[model samples]
Target: MSAHTQIMATVAPSARFDPDLGVIMPPSNGMPRSVFGRPVAPLAKWRRRYAACLVVLDFVAAVAASRTVVALFQDADAGFWDQRVLGDTVSAFVLVANIGVPLLWLVILAGAGAYDRRALGRGTEELNRVVRANIAMAAAVSFLALGFKKDVSRATVAAIIVGLLVYTVFVRIVARVALRRIRRVNQRASQKVLLVGRLADALAVHEVVTRNAGAGLRPVAIHLPQYPRSGERVNAPVPVYVGWDLVPLVQQLRADTIAVCGPASLESYELRKLAWQLEGTGIDLVVVPQVTDVTGPRIHVRPIEGLPLLNVEEPTISGLSLLAKSLIDRIAALFGLIVLSPVLVGIALAIKFTDPGPVMFRQSRIGHQGKAFKVWKFRTMYTDAEQRLEALRAHNESDGLLFKMRNDPRVTPIGRHLRALSLDELPQLINVLMGQMSLVGPRPLPTEDDDYRGDVRRRLLVRPGITGLWQISGRSDLTWEDAVRLDLHYVDNWSLVYDLGILWHTVRVVLDRRGAY
Candidate 1:
C-alpha cells in the first residue's frame, strides 16, 4: 500500500462489530476507537481541501481580467475611462480597484458556496453560483458608488464586470476539468462505496455509478439486506455480502461511503438504525432518493419536526421566464439570420446548383404536447434519398432510435461538408423566430418514433430544440437507452442556467462534428 494509505495502522485497537447492529458499539467516550478497520484512503478528505488552492487561482484571474479590461479602454478615443473618483487620479483609482475588486469577488464566490467541494465538478450549479455572485457583486458596487457620490466611469465598471465574470468562469471550468482528470488518475480519489439495498436496487444503483465516471462513486461491494448470510447470487458484477454486517464489510473493503438507494429491503426504521450506527464509524452515509433525473434546484430537503421531508417542485416551462425565453429566442434568431445572411444565401445557392433540388427540406416532426410541425433544415440528402432509405436500412450506423449512416450515398458531396460543420442546421433559426422551437430543448422526434409510449413522451412538454442534450451528448452514436435518458434528464431538469450550459456544450459538440449523419 502507498504510505498515504497506511495511516490506519497507527490507530488504536480494533473493536469487534456486532453483526446484527452492523457496527462496533461505542466505548465509554461514545466514539469508536477506530472507525476505519483497515487502511482507508485519505483522498476523500483531501479532495475537499483542494478547494483552498482554487480560491487563490480565482483571485489571480479576477485581478488579471480587471486590469486587462481597464487597459483596453483607458486610452480609447471615446474617453470612457476619464472620470476621477473622490479627487483620485486614474492611478490611485486603479490601485484601490486592484485591491478591492478581487477581494469582493472572492468574498461573493465564497458566500455563494461556489468554492465548496460539493459544488466543484458540478457544472450547472457551480456556474450558476459564480454567475449569480458576479452579478450581485456588480449591483452592490454600483449602489455603493451612487450612494457615496463616487465619480467613476460607469462604462469602465461595466466592462470590468463583464470581463471578470467571463474570465472567472473560464478559469473555474479549467480547474474543474483538471481536478476531474487528476481524480481519475488517482484510484484512491474515487469514493469506494458499499451499496446496501435490495438486489434490484443494487444493480440499478451500480449501473448509474459505473456509467457516470464523473460522479466519483466506485462501488467496492454490494450488501443486500434481503439476502441471507450465506449469500445469493447478485445480478451485478460486485461481490454480494448478504447480511447487514455493514461495519465489517465497510472496513474490510476500505469503503468511504455507504450509499443506500431508495427504500427496498430496509424500512425507514432500519435506515434510521443504520444511520445511527454509521455515525461514529466515519463512513459517509448518503441515501439516493427515489426521485431520479430531477435537478438540484427543484429537490429541496426541509427538516420538518426531526424528519427530513423532501419537496420536489413540479417543473414548469411556463410563466414569465418562459416568455423571456421566447423573447430571447426570437431576438437571437433574428440577429443570427441577419449576420449569417451571406452564408445562408451561399448554402442555398450551393444546394440548388449541385443537388438540383429544393434548398430546404421540411419534415413532419412531433413538437411540444404532440403538436406537429414541419421542421426546416438545409436539405443535405438528395431529392430521392427518402425513397432509397429502405435499401440502406442494413447500413444504418446509429445505435439509437434515429437512423444514421456515416457515409450515406444519398448525401451530395457538398452536403457532407455542410453536415460535418453543422451548417446544415442553420436554417432552423427561422423556426426559432416562428416560436415552433427554442434555442435549446429536447430534439424533436420524427413522427415515426411516436410508437415510444414510455415516459419518453414527456419530452413533448417543451418545444423541441434545434440542439439539445442528445445532440451535445453523442447524437447518433449514443445507445438508445443513453439518448432517452439524456432527453428525459433534460426534460426533468430544465432550468435557465441548464439551458445556457447545454447551448454552450452544443457549440463544442458541433465544432467537433461528432456523431454526425
Candidate 2:
C-alpha cells in the first residue's frame, strides 16, 4: 500500500485500540503553542473579573440613582427634611433598601439570562428584559411600602424607577461596547475550540463560529465520526480529524474547549460513553441541543440516581397566566383602537375609493379549542379573492395545508401596501379585545381540510395570535416544516417575555417587508 493508504488502514481499525503511553510523541513543528503568544490564565481571569465588576457597577449605579432622586425631592419640601424622614435612621434604611432592591433585581436579571454574552449588543431584547425585571421589582416594593405604611412619596418612587432604567441602560450599552472592543483587540487570544460532530453539523458549526469570530470561539479542528481518513479539507480555515484520532489530536492541539454537536445516528449508550471518556481532559465540553429557539428556561435537568434526565415542560397558558394575558390583550386592544381610529378611518376611505368593496374582510378561522371565529382584517384582496384562490392553487409555495403566493394577481393596490406593512392585520386587535385571539400565540389558521392533523392541531390549545413566530420568521417564505417547528417551539417555551420579544421583532420584520405575500 502507498504511505497515505497504509496510514489510513492503521487508523481505521474496527475495534478501539489502546495507546501506549511510553511511545515517543511526535515533535512540534515550531507552530506557536500559545494563542496570540499569551497564556490562557490571565485572559480567563480578566473575563471573570470584568463580569463581576459589571454586576458591582450596576448595583452601585442603581443605588446612586435612587439616592439622587431622593435628595432631589428632599430639597423641594421642608416637611420632607423632617428628622424622621431625612435623619440618619431614615438615611440608613433608604441606603439598605436601595442596595438590597438592586441586588434582588440583578438576581432576577440573571435568572432571565440578561447577562449572557451572546445577547450583548444584539438589540433591545436584553434592555426590555432589564426594564421588565426592574418593573417587577418596583411593583413588589410599592406593595411592601403600602403594607408597611412607609411615607415614601409617589413622585420619589417614580423618579427612582425612571432613574434606574436610564442608568442601567446606559451602563449596559457602554459595557457591551467596551467588551466588544476588548474582544477585537484580543481576537487571537480567544478559546481554541475542537468541534466534534457529523460532517454536516461540523460544517454548520464552523460557519457559525467563522461568522462571529469576536464571540471568542476559534474552531481549530473538526472531529468526524467513522471516517478514519481525514476527509477532503474544505475551504474553511479549520483542520479535519477523523475517528478515534480526536483523543490524541485534542491533546496535540491543546484545545481548551470541545463542542459536541448532535450525534449522527449513534446509540445513546455510545454517545454517553464518548462523553465520559472526554471527562477530566482539562477541556470544557458543551453539548449542543437538537431543539432550536427553545429558551433555556423551558429545559430542566434532573439527576435520577446516576442518570441525568432532561425534563421539558409543556408551555402553560391557563389559570393566572391566561387571566394576565387576557387583561393585557384587552387593555392594549382598547387603547390601540382609540389611538389608531383616525388611521383606520383613513385606510377604510382609501380602500373604498380605490375599490367598490367593503372596507373589512371577515373570514372564519380556527381559534382556541378548534372553535370557529370570524377574524377581521382590512380588505387587502379583491372581493372575489377567495373564489380566485383555486385558480392559483398550482402556484402555492407554502408546505402542508397553507396556500401562499408571493405575487398574487388578486391583491388590491392599497391591500398590497397594507399587507407589506402588516397594517391590514390591525383589525385583529378587535379580535383580541373580543376574546377570540391573544396578543401572542400560534397564528390562526383557516379551518380548511388541509391545515392541520394529529398533534399539529394542538396549536388551537390557546387563542391564535395576529403576529406570531411565523410572522416574524418569514411569513409565507417559511416552509411547512419550518412554520410548524417555530409554532411548536413557541408552545414549548411560551412566556410573557417571549410574547414581548415576538411583538418587538414583528415591528422590525414589518418594516423590512420580509416574507409578506
TM-score of each model, in listed order: 0.77, 0.67
Candidate 2, lDDT over the whole model: 0.70
Cα lDDT of model 1 by residue, 135-251, tens digit: 888897788778977655667778878877888888888876676666566744567898888767877889877764555778876776753434332344755555335665576
RMSD of each: 6.2, 8.5
Q: Per-prediction count of colliding residue pairs?
A: 0, 0
Over the stretch 341-423, how does candidate 2's per-residue lDDT look in tens digits?
99999999999999998999998888888888899999999999998999999998776777788888999988899989989
The true-versus-predicted C-alpha distance at residue 480 of model 2, in Å, is 1.1
lDDT of 1: 0.75
Clashing pairs in 1: none
Top candidate when judged by lDDT against the true structure: 1
Q: What is the Cα-based lDDT of residue 332 in candidate 2? A: 98
